[model samples]
Target chain A: MAMPFEARYRVYWHHTDGAGIAHFSRILAIVEQAEEDFYASKGLLHVHGRLPRREVYASFLYPLRRGDEVLVRIWADEVRRRAVRYRFEILNLTAGRKAAEGHVVAVCVDSEGGELKAVECPQEFVEAWKEA
Target chain B: MAMPFEARYRVYWHHTDGAGIAHFSRILAIVEQAEEDFYASKGLLHVHGRLPRREVYASFLYPLRRGDEVLVRIWADEVRRRAVRYRFEILNLTAGRKAAEGHVVAVCVDSEGGELKAVECPQEFVEAWKEA
Candidate 1:
């Protein structure tokens, strides 16, 4: 089962440059916020924990302009032994175009804060996420 | 001639993770500050302006741990028509290792906020940076 989450973000002055377009870095911030919300919706409390050994990367396919109303869609794509893969889609509401698409991979780690390790998916949490 | 600028940044709580290491994004922020300082050192006032059509990108080569004092080096590597290339190197002071190496490319844009155009290098500004 996959969990899905949607979020709306407003373009702010801080998010734009003198040309009135969003800086590349600002787009990454919004995608990050959507990912945070995805985890919170899953009923998990590891928001601030050190993510084990997973890596996250993003690429911008199109430039987002300031004052553009955007919608971000997030969902889990797969879950492996100690890792989970998530995907994101950014849509430009005003122009009806796909602005960007990204994916993130996270690995579960031990509580000892040692090396990243694989763990079983918490069935209860997974179920709650599916319901959400 | 190459321009030089140096700035010291402390690893803050918001800059790290549960593993107590600096998050990759925070490193980009530090590098960005250095680039800003580089421009300011040259007496250029377009800090808040839309960088014409120039594109900038960054990559992380190594992980930086929390409480680590890292030094970043920024210098011009090449200049082409309508484009300026800059490079960054992150050094780990405690262990004496190069933490990361990255580069950014910024294009000069027109004042009307239209298409980016390559203008003759501002002779005065470039010379000012040589002395800084």
Candidate 2:
């Protein structure tokens, strides 16, 4: 199996809640950022904004605090004709533990005539994954 | 089974992405807001921030845009000794459809001496759910 693509982020004040830990909702945003970086690194920036999430899930194992740096790793676990499922893990480098892990299923859609129509994955996306 | 508690929210510019719809990450925040409202309505405001999510999941069925009013309904689907599972639905009142649905599992914890220790549900929490 191919190694997962990784991206690094620092916990910011905006990402933390009153509990002084990164808000659980921010975990999804962090993973999505890693996904974007992965696609951009693969020169598939055109794929951005074309795929919207159909479903997303995350499990929080540890708390992450502001100023802490985290490493996000992502894998294109499943690539289908019309969708892709990306699995991601957010490792708290400061604490040396997994902070959270999740998967997002995004489906390709074409927004033409002000309507969103489900579409097959772009050829570029398929080719990018094939190369990865 | 009892009727779920409901809260209303409007999609704002901050909640939207370049896709012109509410960002998927915002869905979790929206549901959490509803959960907070539910607890507040039950006079269990102390429960806020005491429960951190163990896992969360969401499925988006329709898009919600800026200026759209949404009705979020939440139910304490399962209340255990140390955790609560909340099921929620986001209804797009403007579009008259289910925009998203999800569940969050939060476990009770106590932060004493700077350590997060899993603890039993508060008496107030148990009493609140029992009344519900």
Candidate 3:
């Protein structure tokens, strides 16, 4: 298993509720942002990608209360011929508790309607993530 | 118990995932929108409300699969001295299944941080929702 890349963020007002805790939806937003950042860090800029070459699916496991400084740890769980699995775990850094955990599955295609051949994890990308 | 107001919406691309189903967070988004619509339907514009008079809290009960045409039914469960409870139910209109259910709890407070007195459900508001 590879060590997940960690992203830190503060609980902002817009991300919280009247009770002063982060809204549950905002946690999903944070996780999605971290996933995008992970792909962008690997030179896969989703902003320009077309043809639905890759698609992400995710699920929520738990809620993150407001005022909790959290850390999102993410990793590509597996890379296969057509699909890649990414896992996530959100930690309550202050309390050192596992607040949430989930995974996303993405499929790779090509610019055209045809499928891309020979999918392999980039050595540098894998190494960098494993080191993280 | 009163009948809940129902809101219907299509599952757009922005609201779905690779699995072609609506994302969980998007469910929350719809519920929030319906709640706002309920208040606005009764002539209460949240955009202008100040003094921290009322606040809302929500929780998720189940997952809504993508491509699922959903009907979000919302209603005020109760109105007390300082709190209002709103309940929600997501129905799979096609399969005729109860996909999810949850509730939101809101508190009423004054502009200067004082508590509001004698909170009561406006008749027009309650009647409107009941008819809806």
Candidate 4:
């Protein structure tokens, strides 16, 4: 199992969604931010090819409210020739609980001069994960 | 087959997510907004109680960018005693394509005086849905 990446974020009031709880849609926004952080830290940001999201799954265990802080924890669940699945857990730090659990899969792709095409996992990225 | 609920929305630049395309998560925000519009038109807003989201699934078919115009289409996919699944399609009206498709399942619940508990679907809601 790969070690998960963790980051913290606070809910804001801009979108005082239904009942004041965080909108379910924003959970993945947090997930995506943390995921990008993970890749950036390893210096693989754009040196590696782009990843287009394919699917997303999320299950809410408890509601998250405005001003509530949380930990966005993510890990690579599966890596294959063309896709990588990242699992996520939004841990509510304020209430000390898991707010939600989810996963998102991004398929690897190569783009050059505005042309796009699906590609296999870059060997360096695969090796890096293996060593992680 | 049931007629789907439909509404229009425009992309804003506030959180011009990754690569200038709309954040994958916000597709559901559009979905949720359209869904509430549908319920509100039926005059069922809170008269039947709340619907706490349980599960969400989304698949991206094409990228949606800021300034893009879209149609958020939604409808009930399943109706049970406790859960009603709403399917959504974010149609890129400006680009003439399907930007994304997804579903969110919200379970009926009864909440009174700051307490919450899951409850079966109210008969009135079911009947209204049937008549629609």
lDDT of each: 0.61, 0.86, 0.57, 0.76
DockQ of each: 0.18, 0.90, 0.09, 0.62
lDDT for model 3: 0.57
Interface RMSD of each: 4.6, 0.7, 11.0, 2.3
Across A1-132, the per-residue lDDT of candidate 2 in tens digits comes to 467888999999999898888899887788888888888998887788988899998999999889999999888778888988878899999999999988899999999875567899888897665544
The list of candidate 3 runs beyond 4 A from truth reads A1-7, A11-24, A31-132, B47-67, B109-132
Model 3 Cα RMSD, 1 decimal: 9.3
Candidate 4: residue A25 Cα off by (Å) = 1.5
- The DockQ-derived docking category for candidate 1 is incorrect
Model 2: lDDT to the true structure: 0.86
Q: On residues A1-132, what C-alpha lDDT tens digit does candidate 4 reach at each position? A: 557788898988853465666777776677777877777777777733378788999998877777889899887787777877778999989878888998898888776543336788787666555543
Candidate 1 lDDT over residue span A1-132, tens digit each: 444688988767788765666675667678777766766765565632534324444544445677778888877676565556667788878667676776666555554443334565566545544443
Report the C-alpha lDDT of model 3 over B1-132, residue by residue, as the tens digit. Answer: 556777886566788655345565666678777767777776754521321212223333323554567788987777554556677887877656766666655544333232233344455544554554
State candidate 3's TM-score: 0.47
In order, the TM-score of chain B in each prediction is: 0.71, 0.93, 0.65, 0.86
- Candidate RMSDs in Å, in order, are 5.5, 1.4, 9.3, 3.1
Cα distance off (Å), candidate 1, residue A61: 5.4
> Which candidate order results from sorting by DockQ in descending order?
2, 4, 1, 3
Candidate 4 chain B, which ten residues in sequence have the lowest lDDT sum?
B14-23
